[model samples]
Target: MPIRLASRSLPLLLGLLLALPTSLHAQQPTAVIAAEASLESWYDPLEALGTLRADESVTLSATVTDTIAELNFHDGESVEAGQLLVRLSDNEAQADLRAAQALRDERRNTVNRLAQLQSRNLAPRGDLEDAQAQLRQAEAEIQALEARLSDYRIHAPFAGQVGFRDVSVGALVSPGTELVTLDKLDVMKLDFTLPELALGQLEPGLPLTATSAAYPDTRFEGEIDSIGTRVDPVTRSVTVRALLDNTEDRLRPGMLISVVVNRAPRQTLVIPEAALIPEGHRQFVLTLDPADEHRVTRREIRIGARREGEVEVLDGLNEGQLVVAHGTERVRDGQPTRLLGILDETTSVPELLRRGRDEAEASG
Candidate 1:
């Protein structure tokens, strides 16, 4: 009888031990970082990979085949519009131009003499008319020669930086031979592609931000300059072009960039992402009871767009309500809690705990 009684009491003892921990845990307040759900502007982001390009870019080449006579620009030199960059051998063209000028002068003298003689009835009207025609032809010939001479020279079409010079003085070059590259760098054009599904939201003037691996810490800001006229049938995407100010000249052509386009802003309840508790497909958070600040209630919530360290709470939460941002694993529904410092984007769980310990010692 004594052995049987001991066995029954052993089970009771185990049960009591388990019950004691629950009672103690319920009374002991758990310390956790808390945050308030507040109303803030929220944006939906569309992301894509982009390629950077100069606002204006072109490859300079010779218009006619000739030998390079003069190189006025060095590699990577900045030049202004209409500035002479190269002068090919134009000796033959110059000679022709001089001859045309002399012929024009002679024709002009002949026309004047004939006009004077015709006015006094000493020359025929046909002779004066013929001289006038010859003078006009000579002038036209001079214009044609000047135009041909222009083909032997190269000028900067716009103000920009020039790339490497491909030829040197006395080097033979032909038509379509690349002389250099010119790019306007004061503004940058970012071209990216987005899916056709995003076409409705895409338009000119939409704000965006971009980042490059080369400059990881820098964020480039710009606005949409235009949208593509047609969607690409193969990719089911449309091209987007944005203009970013490059006054500092930090951006370059062909740099790979990651882009984020922000949609219209709307007011929504936002909370630190640390406060969320994920269970399968649903989400939950521990909220402090209004009547009992120490007590917590596990509430289910729906979430929307998330960015950085914060998340948008779509349902089951109200603005200005307090939720446990940290130590959710240590607390249970209806369990008592001790408030620590509120968690923010810049604050960490360990930092908040350190502050709590300091405050407790001060108060004691």
Candidate 2:
């Protein structure tokens, strides 16, 4: 049970703290637990709404006007890089290629014949030049035909999940027509916005946790991948981007998620929250003087953040000094008190809080 300092304990504590003439202090020796203040590192984490985006996304389309000859992928199927996706009717391109090949063969023979005749001094230099120009022209035509054939076939640019398609075999598609969509979902880009005030803490590679209503029981882990170059003028918020692994392929693009960023922790002196005795707005704690355990003093303290049932002491205390965490109601300025056994140094913060709570409850 926590020790509750009440009017009854206060009188005894005041006498011990005040040193009340050696006679009075000796008369009322109030034993109290003294625990040393500890230095701990603490951090304040922030949460913001964010979105999931694919590592890569694209709406696949055709570059040439032609009839679709084949559709190689099914809706929602995974595909590999360079995998055939759609094949347009290549009759025209292939025919052009064959014709160019035949023309190139004919031109090559003509050039070889002209070269031999010139070597024999039977053909003029102009004849060989003309034949060579024709061979070059044929080669150029074959290249153009090959390029055109490529437009007739569509290959996956990267490995990804393919979305549904509206085009079917034998359907004619024009340039710029939408065929289907593909997304690289192995890793996702998570984007969120934070107020400009949080900009100071913004940095790359910080740890993050992401959760979504769609998957309430599960949490996804990630890290800040990048930050936006500028903040939104109207909203006064900066955009942050994070990278999350989706190897399990559970997280999808365009999903709404909640992101928690674990910022760097700062060091500070900390003590049990129960140690603070609040008198109106100001707070104070009772501590035994290091030089004399019999003398107790009231120390005013400024607090910062509170966590794990412990409060940060901004001032008026240093680490390793013993403080009266409980039975503070009885302690008064400059009182002399009997020493109780010190709290075990290994006792955890959670255990201390539980003990303090029980003591308060029992006293009530």
Candidate 3:
């Protein structure tokens, strides 16, 4: 009978030992990194590739064929509008101007003398009229010569920087020969294209940002100033133009850049992306009990758009509630938890873990 009692007691004692560990595990709180849901401005981003261009660009060239007489600018020199850049050979033209001026003076004297003589009846009316016509013709000739003289010179059309000089002094050049290039670099224009579906979200004065591989650490801010009226039928896309301030002259034409257009922006509740526990098609999060910080309850949440390190919580989560951001793998619904630290979009996970370890060592 004593032997029979010992066998029954052995099974009961084994059962108790197994139950003890299970109860202890349930009672012990799990350590986890948590993050608070908060409201922040969120933007839907539209990305595209863009090309940079100067606000105003032109290739300077001479309109008339002639030998270069003088060069007043160097390569990459800034000039003002109407500044004389090059003077072609005008020696022959100057001689003609002087002779025309002499003839004009002679005709004016004849006209004046004829008027006086006609008033005294010493000269016939026809003679006075003939001298007047001759005087007018001489003046017209001088004006025509002056206009032609302007063609032999080159002047800057606007205030900008000039490119390299392709020809030297005394080098004969013909019409359409490129002399230099001028560009107004105080402002830059960025052109990019987006699909036709994005047209409804684009308009003038919309703000944008751009980045370039040349300046890896820099970001350029601009706003939409123009939108194409027609969409490409083949590509189903529309062109957009933005204006960026280039006061530093860092941007240049034909540079490939990345563009981001901030479309719809609004304030929405957000949490660190790591806090979401995705199960198949649905999403869930572990939230701490307000009254009992060590107790956590698994919650099903609806989410919207996601940015960088955070996600927009559309439903099932309220602002200011804490959710598990780290160590979600070892946690379960209605599990007791110990708060390690609060995590945010800007927080580093490894750093947070180190801090938690240090705190644990201090407490022990």
lDDT, candidates in the order shown = 0.91, 0.86, 0.90
Q: Which residue pairs of candidate 3 clash?
A: none
Q: Candidate 2 has what TM-score?
A: 0.71
- The better-scoring model by lDDT among 2 and 3 is 3
Sorted by lDDT (best first), the order is 1, 3, 2
Steric collisions counted per model: 0, 9, 0
Best by TM-score: 3
TM-score-based ranking: 3, 1, 2
TM-scores, all candidates, are 0.81, 0.71, 0.84
2 against 3, candidate with superior TM-score: 3
Error of 1 at 167 (Å): 0.7
Worst-scoring 10-residue span by lDDT in model 2: 24-33
Q: Whose lDDT is greatest here?
A: 1
Q: How do the residues 1-364 of candidate 2 rate in per-residue lDDT, one tens digit apiece? A: 9977777788888878767587654465455667778887776779999999999999988899989988999999999999999999989789889999999999999999989999999999998999899999999999988988988888889999999878788898999998889999999999999999988887898888899998899989899999999989999999999999999999999999999887876788888888888889888889887587557888899988787678889899988988886567777778777655456557654566577667658977
